[model samples]
Target chain A: MSEFEALDFYLMDELLSDEQRLIRDTVRQFVTEKCLPIIEEHQAAGTFPTDLIGPVAELGMLGANLPEEYGCAGLESSTYGIMMQELERGDSGLRSFVSVQGALCMYPIFEFGSEEQRREWLPRMASGEVIGCFGLTEPDAGSDPGAMRTTAVKDGDDWIINGVKMWITNGTMAKIAIIWAQTDDGIRGFVVPTDLPGFQAIEVKGKYSLRASDTAELVLEDVCVPGDALLPKSGGLRSPLMCLNQARYGIAWGGIGAAQACFDEALRYAKARITFGKPVAQTQLVQELLTEIASEITKAQTLCWRLGELKDAGRARPEQISMAKRNNIEMARNTARRCREILGGNGILDEYQAFRHMVNLESVYTYEGTHQIHTLIVGNALTGLPAFG
Target chain B: MRIAVCMKAVVDSQARIELDGDGNLRQDQLRFEVNEYDLYAVEEAIRLAESDEGHVTVISAGTADAVQGLRKGLAMGAADAIHVDCDPDDLDASGVAAVLAAALHDGGYDLVLAGVESDDLGGSQVGVLLAEALGYASTTLVVGTNEPVDGAMQVRRELEGGEHANVQVQFPAVLTIQSGINEPRYPSLKGIMAAKRKDLAVKGLADLGFDGAPARRVESLGLTIPPPRELARMLEGGAEETAAELVRILREEEKAL
Candidate 1:
């Protein structure tokens, strides 16, 4: 029951008001029932649970932490983590779907969009009527997005955008993309309609990790955007990094959920499957592995709880997210391996699900910011040195 | 229409539980969670409210400790909640059922649902007894449901092993939901915040008009941990040898290959 382990550390329950527990439990239930069943199948099909959009919206998951009105769910940062943890408990790909759509895409528009623009798009996005995607990483410029070749030029009352984005989640199906491109004003975001005359998206196939997630390559050529489509207040590399920061925080909690699921599966398998005439649970090594994995999960939970508090309090900086992103995700990857060991041969199969989880952990390890990228971010924060070349 | 759901505050059943000295459950050492199976009931109630013209209320028959579990239900869109507020030592499922029945009567809910059993206890009797106490037709393991007419209702019940049976019963009937009836919705942040002030209905024994009545006796409950396995048993062998040993063990020793 590593997955179901009611985590209470450092009197965390007392720290959370009654409302926090309620929210966490509600998300927990939704993850267990809704996401867990169909997640594997969707991954196999290389498609998304499009039907889930309405349900997710109804649960107020989309733009959930945004303010009330405009049909927003109006939760706080930690509450968003609650959603991520539960969603990723089913599959990291599914959680990534929400994080990209909500945190990476809608958030920038909400933060920097013109009032008229907000009034137009926020409600529709909130209602799941129009799905959104963020375009930041490009084929040529990935970790260093400041070097992006994608460009937008000003024309009277509009911006002509031309570029390609790689590894875009929800790209193929999204009706909107909050794309970042170099303008004369430097890197700026535009809430471009994907159906624009020259915009194209095709699903990215052949991924061993996050297979359940729909990632696509976005090609925008001479895509014209009205003045209203641009996020006017945002400028500089800071714009997209801010979005990445939000997504990373959610990933911090989400990675732990995946680890917990694997730990739970392994722990159960070890106890029930007898080896050499006795239950494997009785073995010290098996117990040791289980113990280590669960402890890692608990530690990750405690770290995320603190991170959530820091984020909700508005004291969280990029390095705080980077530290957690680096540590928790690697912790998840390690825990998945340990759990995979516990299941032995059954671990390799999809139904038992440890191997897929292990595989998915690899994608999680690389996305948003790779482990090395987060490490450099933290290193730079500590020494006041920029490590990324 | 008004609906009520009975729930338990169980340690996440998937959580690893350890016992303390002198035979009491060391919940302090264990990871705490809302009972897993009960969540299906909470989700169903939420869906029902969303679909119909009804209000859903949740009630649990435990003390301050049970508050978290009730809040979890409330956050899943239950309109209100109540806690019987009793000690954890109270053992009788019937006693728990009695408190729930009292809450049901007081709340005036037209329909009630419960998970067929607590994941920890798997006691599939509480809903049945509560239904009897309230004088309503009760069914367990409902897998599907239909709209309730003014006074009558219909539900699809899951029978033994992949089979299903549908039945209609009158108002005030109790139907226990089976797992996977519907994917339970997570509590929206709005639901979570709203659940905060929704009245826990905390009451003492006198308020429910009962003082420790029992349907069954507790005859010593304890957990036993099997002896640890010896370290020498784990063999370090190559794949072929491992497979041969596994097959031999599975066939000759355990009598199943």
Candidate 2:
């Protein structure tokens, strides 16, 4: 009961199937029992809970929404969204780990890899036997991935890959990496094993946000891979962008989870902590903060739910995902800040989750396409004009 | 071995309980989950079945919401489930026991497991009454159960004053599991999906050939929160003066000196 209970103001459960509800409840219980208890310590120590990988895989969460042929759960997209929401309710770091493994790494292999590659990796990755990471962003290219300096040269039947992928989630722990690079044919993806020569993933330290997650800078110098390493279906940058869209959809749901956590903490603290002869929750100013956050969370829930439906129907566009990610993350950031203020001095401590979520929201807001980049994407869709130079 | 676990869906103990004008719980504002003790029983049953290469069947007697608990049990690897469609408000502990006993009498189960008590009512009578109704040997407050030996099971029972007694019961027995017997596993995603496809048989009280009326019914009088404690008075003076005043108060007022 010390953990935050999810707030469902609009009876959104009515929109979900029974299986989806069961999945959500299952993940919610897992988060409450497993993740909530150890998150603060892990976050403080700046170490991922590596022991959780086995249990998490047992939950069928790694590639839950993918096809069952790949040893996934074969759940609907909305169920996956709910899983992400519950994971983020525990910590953004946990959700980020799942998003990287499922959407960024496994998704490309499922969507663009050859049948042989999928056969070789998907089941193992799904079972947590082999961890995977996605490499797209470089030190110079954060928003503009098309301008990445990473290059791959064809050498007989093998390809020599040379690149430095920055801010890579699961980088240090990944057994294999899905590296997006520029090739003579065009931008392409290569599944390079992390044990290859000249492949080094150095952990990034001194992070104030997402501290429990493993983020690293991947250096690949003269890393060689066979012809089959190249994803056969990857044509251009759109392939990787599609994977980002998948991850961003999960982030959209995850932002709401963080916001809910913040709001729950602030509400609980407001009712319990007394000031001026009464609970702070009774005051109008504090009430305003709670109401605003509650309202925004409800709105974000509706948007994410609709987007999930669209995704399941295969009608959702990247622009739509951009809008949800941009809006919900901003909502989460603002709500986290307000909740921190409502918690007074206690909010600054790691004992309370508001500050942790507030700081983590900053990282979430910046990564997976920043607020400005999403705004431009929406703007281009709205005005029917490419705004990016 | 086919083990049967009896579960119930109860209001979440963590939620603030509010009483209605008629002295009944406010159902609209409350959330429900599988009773805590029942979850332990379900876990123990699943463990027994898994180790013995047997099957588990979870059964619950409650309103429509009880299906949630049954599905949760199924998602935790129960082979199937049965729900006795009866409202808890309409039945006493004996009535529920009768219904469940009737269902399990013909269930062909080797063993029956239930919680020592429910979270809402805290009535520790259902499992024992169920054993009597089904004409089965039963034990309550069972902390642990050893593997089946020659169709008999050895169980460790928690007695008063922190004592434990080991007892052996033959097959077709009942055990009311105590909490903390085992840590229940969360339902895996595949299990959740599988639960959706599993057969959950819903039967009415009459289908079990048991009357819906309770042998004894208890009505709630009212519910109220206990009065808050009085604030402690701070002695605002030097340590010596405060000690002197505190001694005086304890001796003259509190009478503790």
Give lDDT per model, in order: 0.82, 0.91
Task: Give the per-residue lDDT of model 2 (tens digit) for A1-389.
Answer: 46466778998877877678788878888888888889999999999989889999999999888898899998888889999998998899999999999999999999999999999999999999999999999999999999999999999999999989999999999999999999998999999999999999999999999998999999999999999999999989999999999999999999998998889888998999899999999999999988999999999999999999999999999999999999999999999999999999998998889888988889999999999999999999999999886
Per-structure clash totals for the candidates = 3, 0
Q: What is the C-alpha lDDT profile of model 1 across A1-389, one tens digit per residue?
A: 23454434345566666776666666776777677778778878877887778878888888888877777878788878877887787888888888987899879988889888888898899888988999999998888899999999999999999999999999998999999999888999999999889999989888878888889999999999999888998899998999999999999989887887787777678878989999898999998887777777778888888898899899999999999989999999998888888898888887876777788889889889999999999999999989899
lDDT of 1 at A302: 82
Q: What TM-score does the predicted chain A of each candidate obtain versus native chain A?
A: 0.96, 0.99
True contacts kept of each: 0.73, 0.76
What shift in Å separates residue A216 of candidate 1 from its native position after superposition?
Answer: 2.0
Pairs that clash in candidate 2 = none
Chain A TM-score for predicted structure 1 = 0.96
Question: Relative to the unseen true structure, what is the C-alpha lDDT of residue A292 in candidate 2, on a scale of 0 to 100?
Answer: 90
